[model samples]
Target: MTKPDPIPARLAALKTTPTPELKKQWRELFETEPPSFNRRYLESRLAYRIQELAYGGLKPETVKRLEALGEQLDGGNITLRRIRADRDRPIVGTRLIREWQGVQHVVTVTAGGFEWQGRPYQSLSAVARQITGTRWNGWTFFGLKNHRRSA
Candidate 1:
């Protein structure tokens, strides 16, 4: 007889498990009280913990590389890290196309900033201003903001 894998079943049960049960599992796995986050967060963290324990975690080299990358991103400043993390900048080489006044406008995300009509712009809001001659929220103008209602 061969041993069956229990990870898949455990992960599947997370969706149907009650919040209290999920918290209990979190406490047992993490050996600490879970943060006061939502049920989805609890389930997701618990799932990751279960799988990490069953298999393994990232190698030391991978952890070091990720830390180096983070330092490069924010120079180890916690506030800058949070701000950069929250900003959903589009990937480089992406083309953002919008139509205004019956004319099509295209902006290309570059490594340094954005390029529109063969001109470089430091920020999307600046690009928006050039496009519309008025102040506008770039994310909203580009339709990237998540339209979710907060309770």
Candidate 2:
């Protein structure tokens, strides 16, 4: 004679059962109102609850350690990230393309700085000035800044 695999069998049955039936089962199993979760969520949680009843839940020491770690991390104020110039720049090996005065300008992103016309340059504005013969914000020239370019 083989023993019935109750947990898995119940989980499988829970999948096909309707919401009301699952709710009734929940009431019988837990003697409480079922949460308004979806069918799959209900089944999975119910399956876990059934297994927990049959076996056991998290160890007391594990729960205590987790709670202690949570308390340690729960600082009252939210930490703000500082804005950095390096963070504002693109990652290395990225290529940025722009068209000005019916001409296409290409700039390669590098660890040192932006590269243009087979030469390494320190800034995008410098590259833009070289291309346009006028002073311009490197970020604005490259459309990386929050300003709209004039048509």
Candidate 3:
């Protein structure tokens, strides 16, 4: 029986035969860059296999890993910096304004045409200026509170 062709030879032969010239070119491009080469090829191959298992639509564990990968690629952590920058920008006539009538004398100040929590605001700067009586941190002030529901 013949032995199976090795992966590198198979990959390198994709464009043409596995001749010395092709092998040399493939080695030059990929041998010294094993991480990049393996990541480019192996990640997709494995991710696709995982996706196929997930396509069964019932494997919760597999689905979770795929979702995690999606988050990493989307740079969810880095996006936080972008969100802070966005919240600091001034809004121009885009958000709805509401005045609070309680004893606190604070304005509810909805819709500053920006989003601090998941919900959109009228304007982050305007909301900050109006709520705290001083230009305060909009992201901190407007963060959503997850209150536990009473049983």
**Which is the leading candidate under TM-score?**
1
Candidate 1: Cα lDDT at 35:
80
Question: lDDT of all predictions, in order shown?
Answer: 0.82, 0.79, 0.46
Which regions of candidate 2 deviate over 4 angstroms? 1-4, 75-151
Please write out the lDDT profile of model 1 over residues 35-149, one tens digit for every residue.
8766777888888899999999888999999999878877889888545634556779989988988989999988778899999998878898788877677767777557422
Ranking of all predicted structures according to lDDT, beginning with the best and ending with the worst? 1, 2, 3
Best by lDDT: 1
Residue range 116-137, candidate 3, lDDT tens digits: 3344545455565555555544
Better of 1 and 3 by TM-score: 1
Please give the ranking of all candidate structures by TM-score, highest first, separated by commas: 1, 2, 3
How high is each candidate's TM-score? 0.52, 0.45, 0.20
Task: Specify the poorest-scoring 10-residue window by lDDT in model 2.
Answer: 75-84
In terms of lDDT, model 3 sits at 0.46
Model 1, TM vs. native: 0.52
Which residue runs does candidate 1 get wrong by more than 4 Å?
77-151
Instruction: State the lDDT of candidate 2 residue by residue for 31-113, as single tens digits.
Output: 89987655776787788888888888878999988888765654322331112456667889989899999999999999989
